[model samples]
Target: MTTLKSGDKAPDFEGVNQDGKKVGLQDFSGKKLILYFYPKDNTPGCTAESCNLNDNYNAWLEKGYEVLGVSPDSVESHRKFKEKFNLEFDLLADTEKEILQAYGAWGEKNMYGKKYMGVLRTTFVIDENGVIEDVFKKVKTKDHTNQILKSLNI
Candidate 1:
């Protein structure tokens, strides 16, 4: 439930990636960034979404975009997830949920009639200048690359 929309300045964020490397919005300066937030590491929806993106990573690069996945999972968890999926993009370990909260990606979620706080799956398409170009709140997990490409009309 992010309030940020297309044309807004993307929130500044710094996170540790799967390789224990610091990654931030500034690192993507002069490049379009696909910043995605998900709930967990090995879940079905997350896997589908991530795999779809990974499967088409080359196309995204050819079109001038870098992808970054973020989750509340630990660095170790992210590492395993990436390795298992052969993901080419970096996955950020937001254990503290700091970046998630900053982007409004962490909030109340209801499941099975119970409410709990969790990651709100969302993606922000940021431009080279750090401005958000698009926001996907209802991502079609199994075909995310096409979903994003279609929305951006690329």
Candidate 2:
């Protein structure tokens, strides 16, 4: 779960996208950003969540929001995932986990009673000025876009 809350200043991050292009918080200055962190690329839940965002990407863009997905996957993996799914936004490659940790997205996860450190599925809605507008810690994969839109009242 994320410790960040609404009205908090979103932590700045710099990482490479699927195309190996450097992406940083400053790159989205004056723009609302949907920075979502997930466990892995090409997984079932992750794919569902990403596809939901992808399917509604134009709506988000029309609402003046840009989407960026992050995970501890390599650039090549992200590239393949984006290509396979025809994702319309950038997918950041956080193989080093630096960006994930900064957003409190990387932590211990329990699955089948097995505990291990990994990325926690979380979404941070950042305003135009970089302040967090909302933090969705328990995201519903299939309805994530609706959740975000409702939170923003858009």
Highest-TM-score candidate: 1
- Candidate 2 lDDT trough over 10 residues, lowest sum: 1-10
- lDDT scores for all predictions? 0.95, 0.93
Off by over 4 Å in 2: none
Task: Report the lDDT tens digits of candidate 2 across residue range 1-154.
Answer: 4488899999988999999999999999999999999998888999999999999999889989999999999999999999999999999999889999889999998999999998889999999999999999899998999998887887
Clash number for every model?
Answer: 0, 0
Error of 1 at 69 (Å): 0.1
Top-lDDT structure, candidate number: 1
RMSD to the true structure for each prediction, in A, is 0.9, 1.2
